[model samples]
Target: MFKKLKDGVNSLKKKVEEKTGIKEEEIRPEEIPETQETDEKPIDKDSDVKDKKTSFKNKAKKFIKERKVILSEDDVEDPISDFKFDLIENDVAFDVAEKIGEDVKKDLVGQEIKWREDVGKIVNESLRNSILNIFTSEFEFNRYIKETDKPVVIIFVGTNGVGKTTTIAKMAKMLRDKDYKTVLANGDTFRAGAMEQIEKHGEKLDLKVIKHQEGSDPAAVIYDAVEFAQANNYDIVLGDTAGRMHTDVNLMDQIKKIKRVVDPNLVFFVDEAVAGSDAVERAREFDEAVDIDASILTKIDADVSGGAAISISYATKNPIIFVGTGQSYDDLRKFDPEWFVEEIVG
Candidate 1:
């Protein structure tokens, strides 16, 4: 995954080396002394070592004085422009791409490149820090739920065909494996097989499922599930909602009503990582309507550009809690900013 983004970063490294005319070996001050010949007549070994150290220090000072430490704006203009274009072409939002470019430029330009500091390394660190800044909110999902009150209500919301139901099942299994008594609430009564799908998953996991008949009020189903959880002392209540388009006013209003009735502890917006820019916009729309607590991106293993994962959290100002990597219940992995940056830039 993210092959294009990784390749772009590699290209940027080359650009940094080319523009600065500074090789990795040239940046190391220690390597210079090895090339110098030993004195023909060494009076004392300790004195010779001291003299060599002094000579190396003087050479380092002179090298530092002669080399340009600060990069000019014009020197990095072309590389930054190319990077921004690559991000946009890889499905990053336009504003997000611009912000990334601006951040890289701000950190790179006029910065002192010290001894043993490669320009490529500096550029990579600048980009990493800029991307890390976007992930302001980070939390451990399992730990948070464990600490929260019993019968923690969580609602899953997203547009159609984003694997909302399947993601909910995966989460239920995860909580169950953690020894939390979980219950699945089939609140997606508007969909044809939503109840059965969740029910089957519940049966496999040996967890109870709360539901109403088809065409029943979704909020009532959640309310009953919450009530059951409270009565039974269940650890979590995972509610599955019907997939509805964000632009549909009537369906969006239904979700708002569900929120009021259940007052869930967390509302997770599900999306497909492969959906690219469309997923980012949809998440924004849902967040504007009902204010999601976090997000879950499915099909992450299949996504190549990985722009949706990079852009959605920053755009929505919400952290991505987990990403679905495969079809198994254990495929869900918590989002880690450091891991993501390393994968893209290493």
Candidate 2:
């Protein structure tokens, strides 16, 4: 994919260089010297140096005018299909990519066009529609805290190594900043380093984190965490569950048990944007195991195209509550559908 982008840029550079008889770097209109025309004597009145320069400039402009990010008609029966395939190759799920492309096509059909100047606008609008399809809206945080009689419980679930713990910390920070007293439930008691990592994050954020020893029952941990929150009158409770493979029945059953105990208001399927199609597959598995209230897409900064962000939201019909753009606690942000759509198509 990187190679393809580089090849495209190089090809354009070559085309410009061949026509202008100047290096690609020197072709910049602002960088070119103004006195080069006067420095040389005119050779022919009919077809002189000025004429050659004008011809080259025209050729260069024509080449640039034809530049396209999408494929030509000869490349495939459906350019949209080809573009969707490219998106899947960028880590977007096949179904999701297809849906996005179809949505774009639907939005574009029967649109009035006066001139070719609208081509970019049409493509941008199409891609924007595709992105809008993927973005899930976040829950109203203030409403959740203020309206609920019981402490709002948020359970973070995903396959191992998807930054569930880090995301919990970030959310806790957000809650604290909002002046809501938040508690962290260290439900991930299986891995050796899990407790310590979550504990450190809790310490850094200056929030209370409840944890048990290694090999402890995860369900019990969550139950006790809820009890602690209730007793202490915590505004919110965030649980960090043990990372388990979606295929693990024992783990899934345990999660179901925990869900019964806490009955959380929100169950977030935390995923990395780099996972793309795999993220969708994992999300389906997790949703089947437990009711995923919403989604939280992590590692957005790591993804250049962000196909996973679009795919998960579109696939599950679950709102994306937050996006983790970096490893820092401050990188967490609420999902914005409009901005996301504009960025994708543009």
Candidate 3:
């Protein structure tokens, strides 16, 4: 697909060059005027010049219509390099941009493009596909999800303000709508509004949420939620952990303790897609704290230019299980690779 676009642009460049030469050949430097008996003119130099100029104009117009130039790599000192720099400005990693530029060049070098078309379009599509392909890397979420017979606990873990609780709520809503007997564990006992935010979603979904008082032990809250799910008939339990800096060892240890208590079926690392490379760095810390079964990419709808969605799974080696498209529960998507590819490429 990218090759075709590059070829078209190169062809346009060639045609433009050819048309310029043809136009020059059609024009004359001097002209003669027509003879007029009344004026006693020997020749009409001015009239002839005007006629030739009009002729050249018509020919040039025709040439422009028939021929267009397709820009080549040699036509510019560094076309793909400039494009890569633009990508970096858009928050794509330098290394990732370099790889994309190489891929674009490889696909474009030998291709034949049509005249008058912009090669940048090809570059854009190639870059888009390259990024979308990262999100498309598949994994078996059902493997971990179906392994447990009792209440399958899923702990949502991430740094502070990364939409961890909201992602938990979205998951709970999904499970509830599927008739999975869902329970939400508000284990984020540190944040002031964390419990309230989670409870709002729980109320909307009508799912039972277990939350302890603020400043309580998050691990104990998770333990109680697990026990509650087990005692009841709930099939799915989603525990929300307090968000903190990835570098904070104390908070990391707290999450580790919670994982020990719940033995969750999947430890989901929720990160905002707009955070770019920072999202990848945070994932590393969170994954080190617990056995993360998968990842959930949040705020994708507002993060069109960010590459975090593309880079996170590649960095962590954890498959993206879900993508949050918006704040509503219905906005949560199951992270279909095909759909992602289609939407992004189109």
Give residue 99's lDDT in candidate 3 (0 to 100): 74
Instruction: State in Å the error of residue 124, model 1.
Output: 0.9
- In the range 90-199, model 2's lDDT, one tens digit per residue, is 66778777777677667655544331233445556666666665664557756777898768888999998998999999889988998989999999988989988998
Candidates 2 and 3, the one with greater TM-score: 2
Which candidate should be chosen as best, given TM-score against the real structure?
1
Tens-digit lDDT track of model 1 for 67-87: 545678976899989999888
Positional deviation of residue 273's Cα in model 3 after best superposition, in angstroms: 2.4
Every candidate's lDDT: 0.86, 0.72, 0.68
Question: Which scores greater on lDDT, model 1 or model 3?
Answer: 1
- Each prediction's RMSD to truth: 8.6, 8.1, 9.2
Please report the TM-score between candidate 1 and the true structure: 0.86
**CA lDDT of 95 in candidate 1?**
89
**Ranking of candidates on TM-score, top first:** 1, 2, 3
Q: What is the lDDT of candidate 3?
A: 0.68
Native-to-model Cα distance after best TM-score fit, residue 173 in candidate 3, in Å? 1.4
Worst 10 residues of 2 by lDDT: 68-77
Error of 2 at 27 (Å): 19
